[model samples]
Target chain A: MNTHIRVAPGDLFGDGVFETIHLRPDGPWLLHEHLARLVRSAAILGLPEPDLSELPAFTGEDIAVPGVDPGSDVPRALRIIYTGGRVHTAVTPIPPAVLRERRDGVRVITADLGVSVRRRPPWSISSAKSLSYAENFAARRWAVRQGADDMIWFATEGYALEAPTASVVWLAGGELCTVPPAEAGILPGITAAHLLSLAPSVGLRAAERMVTLDELVAADAIWLASSLRGLAEVTELDGKPRPHSPWTPRLLTLLGFPATS
Target chain B: MNTHIRVAPGDLFGDGVFETIHLRPDGPWLLHEHLARLVRSAAILGLPEPDLSELPAFTGEDIAVPGVDPGSDVPRALRIIYTGGRVHTAVTPIPPAVLRERRDGVRVITADLGVSVRRRPPWSISSAKSLSYAENFAARRWAVRQGADDMIWFATEGYALEAPTASVVWLAGGELCTVPPAEAGILPGITAAHLLSLAPSVGLRAAERMVTLDELVAADAIWLASSLRGLAEVTELDGKPRPHSPWTPRLLTLLGFPATS
Candidate 1:
């Protein structure tokens, strides 16, 4: 956890981009995909493309030093933050709340985000994961205040958009679906996209389509997908109880994520 | 400028609130009003109430120190930034761009911000001037890229909203008007509100009304008011030139701002 970086006070305005990568014993998981999406997010923010060569490679040697507990199955979390002044990375142990959600699942509530897909400003950075995350943090805080673990946001038109920090993915019949990023003008979720790419390999059809809250609730199973959290199943929607799905374990394994507690 | 604050890397998320005040030879202008608004903005972001007693006071004597040209007519800028870590303040020279806009005015374009007044999320931080200003910066950048100095945002229902960093105020005959903050769910502009309060002294009626873009375009004159910039007149709207209004200079003077270049 020896992180080093210097930035001006103005950088706190969230006028930057960042990526969170799952750090396994082997190395940073899906490093290339995360880097690519980081570049894309920077472009959306009108920032200069980041120099990938300048990034530090996550070598497994850090976890394999003599006397270290290499036998431990727990994975660390890696975060790369890039502001105007500097780029830096940090590694920290994943919090217990994330593990709890993965194990016992979470209750999720849906609310209107009040954003109009048709009226996105010309410089709209909605599709970019910029650092201006107060609203996102506020949404999660509101969920916690409401006695829920997380919340899903919907467009003003009533289309299910995304979670504050994750992408919404669901299983409906034989197809695995997520909201189309381009159509909804939301940040394209790298983990969700990667999982959708592997859907065919798992003998499941994948589709990207706009869905309503009602339609999402009627789905066979729902999960909030992200790089670090991997996949946290939705055990309840609003106040209604939802049955646990057997597919949760299978999908976690498919994504190279640990399924056991 | 003497600044002595040090913060950690995690402080750059813009998950806080800020206020910019006009520093005059007399003292920091509108100090109490600015402090009050800062507290309100912090409340919107769910931050603990700002302890005003803990803040540094920028007295006129502090600016009268040797080597600080005592006769300089240029107004200083005071900014207060509060985040999860701490609250801090700084004094700096106002940007040349802000002064230029005051003298020569600005050309503005109107774009739909795509947010719904009635449907803001439970955790919506729109009414607060939170530190997560990436989108605000991006919106201004977008306006600059589109061949305009700035932009006026419209709600999804076609009602004229505020600017990226300023409040929209327009003159209609004898009435001075601004958008209603509660009805529109916009950040209440302290400067605009103060100006409206002074309208009666200048023999003009003042009001807060929900105006359409068309109505804004048809106004006698329109200006975006903020702490740093004072007031910037919108000389052009959607590429159409507007007739110069005599009240621009009169109002600036009425509000105790420098009336000439």
Candidate 2:
């Protein structure tokens, strides 16, 4: 949605952190988890403590929309942004492309991000979801130009890291696994963490492993997990096509996401 | 100076480009060059061409500042920020720290940035001064925490790339040299470029060369060049003592910057 707000000039320099939470009719999905992660991100950027206790007080009545019934069950995206200047929150309609990726799959490619996970600078902000997202957006634009839906990044040592805005999740030998965020120096994906926690309920095992790109390509199924998209299976790797996964529907059900394509 | 502006929610995403120009008593320094670079940066971010024709008409009188004379010759900083939402220009007083660095030089350290020039992604935004400056600020903070004033980045290949917010320049064998912007995949430094053009007039040759960190350490002098800082000599690097260079005053004179502390 097109929304405007007054911001200090210093706030535009990207010295801030943000969290995008999926909004449900009941309330914001994983609201506590998202808020806690927001604080962690703020600390990483050296920002002062943010007062988020006032967030839950905001009901649909507090925000005015032209035609949106905030009380409706339609899924929305709530963005909480904090900088040294001030704290801001915005609610926008989830983009149609995200929905499409969830329904259909995504064509994915692997690219070397040229960074060594072991040698990240002392003050590196890689683990923080900072507002400095120009590179992330640029990488996605490059993927689109190359006829791919998204891209996964690998480190110089050939270890899979993460996607620009999501975590890489795969299934191999009946085990659900994701890359360990701290070891990989990548942002921890809250959705991926939540999904892994539910794996046992679905009679599956969960693990965190560091795998080479070659090993990842050999996985039984690969998917990118995030808040908005839920999960987008990697139907094609590089240029090779892979058949649809049988677990996609079951996992969607386990995650409480509607899989009505 | 602290200033407030009206911005869109999207503007806080750091998906934009900016230019900081030195405002002189005559006018903004290198106004046309900075504007042209801003357009180039916008193109790199896939943003539409920004109309900057109205910027030149802004005189200090148009902005209200307390406890200051608009007619005075005090130097100011003219920051032009452009995002998907709109174009904003702000005039603020130069920070005292910047002036101190120019006069007394700076202590710096060398750190591996973990990025390889050979493997830069197809959509690398390093050539554009986008608003993703969190990493830059973080690097400086890291330096300060380590008892230094700034930091320089070296590639995994052992070649000196550039500083987080400035370009690396040095003097050796009677020549003024800096890393070539395109070859090094770094943002072209307007100040460094303009200074190189005046090297011949000061009896020194100008050249672009890729040097390793070891080679940089052996140079007669090393400096970080940028818009606001102009040039800050590396007085101490990686705990090694570097005597004040005799060329510092001469080069500052050639660049039309005051050498007086």
Candidate 3:
């Protein structure tokens, strides 16, 4: 959907926060949670919390059209961007490559992020998903240069932190686990948290733990979970091949995400 | 100064390098050196060297306009922004506050940047003035919150690094000095380098040294030098008041900049 807003040149500085929500036929998935995180992210950046109560309305009629094929499923992505002056929303089609990665999985590598876990700045917003994503883009680019699809960043203390755009989730001994965000000083992953909340119904125990690279590699299965990509299985890690896990498809279906090719 | 360009949404990610130059009546001050550093900064960030030849041609006719006061005696600020897709340039009038800081100087604070000096990332782009400036803006905002005009960052190893948007230069026992960019892992300040190069003619010694916070505070004079704000002296550091230095005016004159408010 086309949307427009006027902004000053200074607004392009990337000192803001954003959230991307999966839009489904049922409605925008987990939108309230996304909005809550957006406010939390803004608070970390010292920005006033955005008011969603008066947000411009986007009706179903605006997104659904008469000529659209009913048989073909319509998948939409909603992005809410809040800077100093403006709060904007836009909708776009899910990228083909993102769908491809979900189907075939991704080749991932691990790298030392070289940031001190104990020495985060007084204004450190690492735990908040702010819009200053150049470093994130750079990390991913570095991984691509290393012949991988994405990267997992570790703290200087040798603890697996998180991916540039996803949360590290693994299964070990029937327990589904992800990093403890506060202890690890990472952005809290809503998708991973939601999945963990549902783990008991799936006959699995859930946990948040500080994991080392060795311990992560030894896990039964590993996945990088995020909102848009849903869950991308780690098919390979650091040039080493990993055996395919049957749980990948099962987890995707459990999350109400389409199994795409 | 109202120039516009067509850019895709992805271009706003701040994945680029930029430079701001002082545009004098003679032309853009130190144009060649700025361009060379732009290329060097791009190299550090692994970005292709921007083609300087493709820069929007700036002619006297372009800036000279009817009804505009040519006798205002206001200096211009030239900004060059280079992303993966495009290199753009724009000119604007320098703000009065920046000019006042250059004249009357600034109150400064020093803080630990919490970055390890020895453990620079393998793909570290610290020496590049990249566009990932959210942290830099955050640093300045921090200083403002702390009741100071700006801040000087110190590495975890205790050596004083540069400020968020400017280079740290100090006078000590007749020697002019700054932190060596390569060794300290900081973006080399072109203005600081140019001032040091001209120091010998004024019978002053010039050198690069790794200095601690104490040594910086004890220096004869300290200044945050940049293109837009020529030299803002540190009247106070970390809330401790400092005696006004005689060298502040001398250095400003030596750099062909205004020495007083």
* All candidates: DockQ: 0.62, 0.85, 0.47
Model 3's TM-score against the true structure: 0.93
**lDDT of each residue in B2-42, candidate 3, tens digit only:** 44444445555567778888877777888888888888877
The runs of at least 3 residues in candidate 3 whose Cα sits more than 4 Å from the true structure, single-residue gaps closed, are: A1-6, A64-75, B3-6, B64-71
Tens-digit per-residue lDDT, A46-97, candidate 3: 8877878766555565554234553456566777888755577666667887
Higher TM-score: candidate 1 or 2? 2
Candidate 3 clash pair list: none
What are the TM-scores, per candidate, against the unseen true structure? Answer: 0.94, 0.96, 0.93
Predicted model with the maximum TM-score:
2
The CA root-mean-square deviation of candidate 3, after full C-alpha superposition on the true structure, stands at 2.7
| Correct interface contacts retained, every candidate | 0.78, 0.93, 0.36
Worst 10 residues of 3 chain B by lDDT: B59-68
What lDDT score goes with residue A93 in model 1?
61
lDDT of 1 by residue, B154-253 (tens): 8888898899999999999899999999888889999999999999999999999999987998899999999877789999998999887899899989
**Model 2 Cα shift for residue A176 (angstroms):** 0.6
Ranking by TM-score: 2, 1, 3
Candidate 2 to truth, TM: 0.96
